[model samples]
Target: MKKDKPKYRQIIDAAVIVIAENGYHQAQVSKIAKQAGVADGTIYLYFKNKEDILISVFSEKMSVFVENLKVIIQESITAQEMLARMIEGHFKVLSEDHHLAVVTQLELRQSNKDLRLKINHILKEYLDLLDDILQRGIQAGEFIEDMDLRLVRQVIFGTVDEVSTTWVMKDQKYDLVEMAPRVHEILLKGIQTQ
Candidate 1:
């Protein structure tokens, strides 16, 4: 697959930075090419267009997220620990990559409806993993068994997503990763049987 090529990875990484700095609508293929150190036409070899590049950027980064969560799920840990680790992992990834945080939290939201729909489709895998974590918690009697699974999933995801977006909006002055534990506590309190 083209994804295995070194240049494909280069273009994806460069696209994140360019989209973060320039906004999705303003981030031209030429700028991405320049940032990737590839010719403008070279991008066409890998992507159908700028929209394809944008979608690919989300797809590639989100796979890292899904894979990380998958590893955490496989560990012999309590549901609480798994949830905590999930929060930490989510926050840590964004905290470590400011450009990616901006692209995902800010730039992606500004895309057209069709583009947002495509991004949402890519997000379903990540959301499903979150559901897996919540389901595990419920099965272990760590969370309430009577709650609506779908709504709970939205609440947890919205909390994490909003916190990251707020941090990005504030230019990331605060430590996001540090906030993970506190956020995890709040979420657990709402869903865990007290």
Candidate 2:
């Protein structure tokens, strides 16, 4: 029996924890392998290099995130509600997974410019979800028609991202979910119907 190809996901999860705690610069393949309870050689089997592991982690987690968001938004009756749900969902996921949040918000940002660009590409799906809601809100007349979709999308995403980062930086003392309504309200101030 093929020794069930050591789940790459398990390695990735271990990488997230290791990277989150050690910071990207200090995290090594050997450390990740040790965290995952696997041999150092096992990592090379699943990834070409450390960078590949980082990118794979983001791609795998983010793709599922986008898919789940799409499904949730589809079930909602109104664009405004969908936007609120989206914001809440985004914060909920990050806040619940403290390791992933630290890796994404802090360690990932420490990556070199080229890797950052690659990560940005992986983030497009999530951004597209926001753009979809913004467009829908515009069509429904719930949001301002004059708004620049791209800029508004950035603002909305940036706002929630900042909130999450602050929560993480402050040792996550407060409940992150509770901030959802306030974040949604602040975002709406610039886009909501007059």
C-alpha TM-scores of all predictions: 0.98, 0.95
How many backbone collisions does model 1 have? 0
lDDT of model 1, residue 106: 94
Task: Kindly list the per-residue Cα lDDT of model 1 for residues 52-91, writing each as its tens digit.
Answer: 9999999999998999999999994878888899889999
Per-residue alpha-carbon lDDT of candidate 2 for residues 3-100, written as tens digits (9 for 90 to 100) = 24556878988999999999888889999999999999989888999999999888877876798789878899888899899888988888889999
* Best model number under lDDT: 1
Q: Identify the runs in model 1 with alpha carbons over 4 angstroms from their true place.
A: none
Model 1: lowest-lDDT 10 consecutive positions: 75-84
Q: Which candidate wins on TM-score?
A: 1
lDDT of model 2, residue 167: 89
Off by over 4 Å in 2: 1-6
